[model samples]
Target: MSTAVATRSGARRIRLDVRLLVLALVMAGAVGYLMYTGLQGTAASYFVTVSELQARASEVDGRRVRVGGDVVTGSIVRGGPGEPIHFRIGDGTSELEVVYSGVLPDIFAEGRHVIVEGLYRNGQPVQADSVLTQCPSRFEAAPTASSS
Candidate 1:
């Protein structure tokens, strides 16, 4: 009788250990799922320059992005109200037109460094939600015209 009771107690202990292991596995799985969802929600790709953008345009469209390039010499066009500014950004190989509605930075100008953030539709230029320009210094001197 004593031997039988000892065996029963040992079996009960083994069953309890198995239940605890299952609970641990369930908890770990739940934590892993939450982590995966959180990472997916915040995933995004970084933007590139005009050349890089053109190369990856198909894959980048409809996704959030930030692109930067030099402003083209003769592509700036200012509009009114809803359409504040329009300009083309270039990286030699390709160019992209950007439309910005909000107030522009003081340094925003032609032939300057610009970074525009937005989405592209079809083959047309991407409309920008934000535009940043790198302007030249005011202390810089302009070249004087030479008389012939």
Candidate 2:
């Protein structure tokens, strides 16, 4: 009877050890999968200037892109009341023509800082889904007609 009880206890210990090992393996796999998916989802390119984008257009085409530059003066054409915006963005040396079919920001005007998010296809600027405009401060008073 004593020998039989000892054998049963040893078998229970082995079963418990196997269960713990399997549980640990499952937890590790879950953690690894979460990490891999998180990294994949957050992997994205960043904003760049028009000149840099032009140089890397071959490599960046057909992928998600963000281009930032100053809006070229005299290049803004407002179509209709709420139609697509057409403008040119430049980085001192070169300019990129851009067409964005979304509502422009309130501060989106000629000579403003703009960041366009879209893809460049076949060396042409594709329309972007989003546009960001950063306007310069105008707190200082300019000489108005009354003052002048």
- Candidate of highest TM-score: 2
lDDT of 1 by residue, 30-145 (tens): 99999999887666334488888777878987776788888899898988677668889998778888877888888887788888988776487787888877667788999899
Model 2: per-residue lDDT, tens digit, 1-148? 9999999999999999999999999999999999999887677435788888878878987887888899999998889967877899998988999988888888888888988888687577757888888866778678668654
Worst 10 residues of 1 by lDDT: 40-49
User: What C-alpha lDDT values do all the predictions have?
Assistant: 0.83, 0.85
lDDT of 1: 0.83
Residue pairs with backbone atoms closer than 3 Å in model 2 (clashes): none
| Model 1 misplaced regions, further than 4 Å | 1-47, 135-148
